[model samples]
Target: MSRPKPNETSSGFESPRTDEPLFQPSSEVWYKDGNTILIAGDEGFRVYAGMLSEQSSVFADMLEIPLPAPQATHEGCPLVWISDSAVEMRYLLKSMLDPRYILKINQTLDLPALCSILRLSTKYNVVHIRRRAIEALQHYFPTTLSAYYNARERRRLSSGGVSTYFLLANTCREANANVLLPSILYSCSAQQLDTILDGVPDSHQGRVELSHKNKSAVIQSRHQLAHLARTGTLRWLYSGEGCSDKRCVAIRRRVGARLLEGRSIDGFVNPLSTFNDALVELIDGDCCEACQNAVERCVDNGREEVWKKVPSVFGLGSWDVLVKAYGQE
Candidate 1:
């Protein structure tokens, strides 16, 4: 709509009267319909319908309200992110809490840089970014996410409406628990897991920390399972997706039968591995078992040193600790 016309104009237009009361300036641009602004000072040409002071307040410790858009070309649709000095406006736009802001951001950003902002948005409490970032991150970093499906960065991510959890889940379902469990356990809740345990029977490890009545029974179940695992009654073997279903209950019966199996209500995670290894697993570690099996053969051939040094091929430092703690684990 056009701005309201000024009354009693003999010349062109007179500025706000100097003697006017402090509260009643003759030409206040507090609202968006004020005719036009010349954009005083040397900031260049533009027309906005709000007070300059109001625009400055959006960045400074001054006013509390926002201004109408000021781009010369689009009028009200200001592309606040185009200029470096407009950083305040950029941040404010990033935090607008509206999903549509992404459309604007996407117009100006590449995928990786976009993902970074999406994550930043989540960290800054921008709700829409939590999900958008996950999708983009997983799409590009799928293997990393898969191996670390339960890792903190992926936890509650889907819950946050990111929906990219499936990307990680698809790739992580088959890895060895001993090798991949720590990454998954890093950020997930007790219930958010199980995809990682695929075929393994519930260890009494299911504590009822949050839900009391059921915690003890679950714990008992896990401890029994872990006991069987520890005693070799439950020989772990890979069968694709999760745990092997065939001899699972049989193992439970043979070993955990005498003792109630249970573990801490919370699932356990081991010490973490290298950043690259961890990221690789979380993204996609489906072939890890086969890879290790080959390495074992090399070690059995009296090539332990050769096998240990193999990690250096992937730019790793040492496997001494891995061999010492859970060799071939």
Candidate 2:
């Protein structure tokens, strides 16, 4: 690793400055039999024209336009300047060159690699490459709450907690994945307020920042989630009051009150499980059979209602919209 070179000033103060090289050499592994060189930032990659042309029409069209005279050359090949990061270029080029260089899917991928493939592939007009990258990300950001939990749980079991949802959400917006916004917004609402503002860093993309629109959505969604938890619970408890067992009903109401006391659905790791457990414990000797059945039915109905309204609660459109948007993939 190169250390920062110290520069002495007239004020007798020494400051570190990075002396970046003018040009970076192409990697031997990537400099295989080639006809063109793609220079990204300071790095150079010598790759075949035919391969790039086959995968990307943009590259093909560019290759067809004959250059006047090459200002720069890498090992006798004409250099094509690209403003993209060298890391992204390498990833994009490697996938096009090597058949067995499998991009990760159905699992947690390095955020930068995932982002690079999605962004660059879309830019280069590589339809299949872009589609695969989009699909891999969609696995994490589903359209519905049930699908979200299922994917989240599967990921948790397989690889523990991955804090890439924020980045995934941002990437989806850039990729024009509006259908996934509701679930992604809900996930954001469940995060710490500080995380929503400061954002998080990943190995590949460095600090993945949230946009202003997403931040505003998060703030609004947080209030909506809390409101739903409070009012929805109360609504279910009072929906049916003509009960034979008054004491049992009173006890159930007390439990519901305690569970819903200034508490937001965001706080519950598994709201459905928590609600079910809280009510199930009351089915013992203390509560009568009639009250138990009533509580069971009430919880079931409340959960169904909540599931149906969860999208609207978070300022999202209906489930039909989410389903339709998901199908656009």
Measured by TM-score, the strongest candidate is 2
TM-score per prediction, in order, is 0.22, 0.72
Which candidate wins on lDDT? 2
lDDT of 1 by residue, 1-329 (tens): 12222233354442232232212111322224433323211121222324333333432231223433222222442311112212222333343423465565534343324433543343334444444543444333332333343334433433222222222222222211122222222222223335323322222223212122122323333433333233231121222223334444343233323322332334321112112332233225343444334323322332222233322322323444422333332
How displaced is residue 265 in candidate 1, in Å? 43
lDDT of 1: 0.31
Q: Per-residue alpha-carbon lDDT of model 2 for 39-142, expressed as tens digits?
A: 67767788888888988999999877876432345567776767787888887777677665544532455544666777788788887877777666567655
Worst 10 residues of 2 by lDDT: 265-274
In candidate 1, position 248 carries an lDDT of 40
For every candidate in turn, the CA RMSD to the true structure comes to 19.3, 6.7
After superposition, candidate 1 runs with Cα above 4 Å error = 1-112, 119-124, 142-293, 296-329
